[model samples]
Target: MPPRPPVPRLAGDGKGEGTVLQVRRLRGGDAGAYQALRLAGLRLHPDAFGSSWEEEADRPLATTAEALEANYVAGCERDGALIGIAGLRRATSVKTRHRGVIWGIYVDPAARGLGVGERLIAAVIEQARGQVEDLLLTVSAHNATAISLYRRFGFEDYGLDHRSLKIGDGYVDELLMKLDLRPA
Candidate 1:
């Protein structure tokens, strides 16, 4: 298969003071920045994700770079810094090829509420179009903000996991959501 062309950079309005938000697919070269942002999220919001900070923080750069190339990871940059990221995990198996996952979406705390998350998700969906028939994600049941954002993008809650993620001594239930990319 030929290489996938680089996704063109998308420009969007950032909140206040002439901030310009640049959203684009992150590449292997972006490992350092991506790791920083991702580790921050994992450390700051342990219950929000299935992956733990301890597990990913120590991962080698080569592995992170390899993972970046294996998946569609979108990064939102503001003033030359990676402030937000979202990833599309497309399936490899033929039976599940019609499905993809929206994963590892995180926006720096300071950049939240300025539509950074929304743009990251939009970029993921744009890349998923024509590539998958459906996109799915599991958000922590307690994360109303993230859940609402997913709903805004047309994701419907299909089920709930009673206790899916165990973080430290607590458990977090997850809401299973899906968005159909096909017309009914």
Candidate 2:
């Protein structure tokens, strides 16, 4: 197997000056923190995330723990508070092994603008390098900040899912984006 990718160390502005936030592969023990951050993201940015907090709030800890243990990178306090998480799950069929979907990307609002999201995405890209030839994700069309971030990370828009999600009494469009990482 290829070596695990290098972990990203991002700096945060929490300690009066700056402190390094550790980004590492999440384990089963991090399920609660992972769920907490994810739920917070959904609550704060409902249009930006695919899953709703209402839907996920009742998920069992075991399910969250399995997800964290299976395929997730978490950014957290060195002392043990999980502030961000991103996941890459490989497609099931053999022909789809070269592709992976990015999901559950969330960073605590308190940790925003501190490079946590960048570190999380970098970790995702690094992990996808060998296993996947392409990666895909969807973002709310109105999420300009996220779109800009994805663009900076080399993703390109391929299409849009019109009114993909029902929000309030209406709907929101989803911008489909892909990043190709195959060796040339």
User: Which candidate has the highest TM-score of all?
Assistant: 1
Error of 2 at 57 (Å): 1.1
- Over 1-184, each residue of candidate 1 has an lDDT whose tens digit, in order, gives 2233333333334433446788998999999999999999999998888899989988999999999988889999988999999999999899999999999989999988667887888889889999998999999999999997888778889999988998768889999999888644
lDDT of 1 at 47: 85
For all predictions, the C-alpha RMSD in Å is 5.9, 4.5
Worst 10 residues of 2 by lDDT: 1-10
In model 1, the Cα lDDT at residue 132 comes to 91
Name the runs in model 2 displaced over 4 angstroms.
1-18
User: lDDT at 74 for candidate 1?
Assistant: 97
Candidate 2 lDDT, 35-135, residue by residue in tens: 78888888888887778989999999999888777775655553467887888887989888889888878877777777778788888888888889889
lDDT computed for candidate 2: 0.80
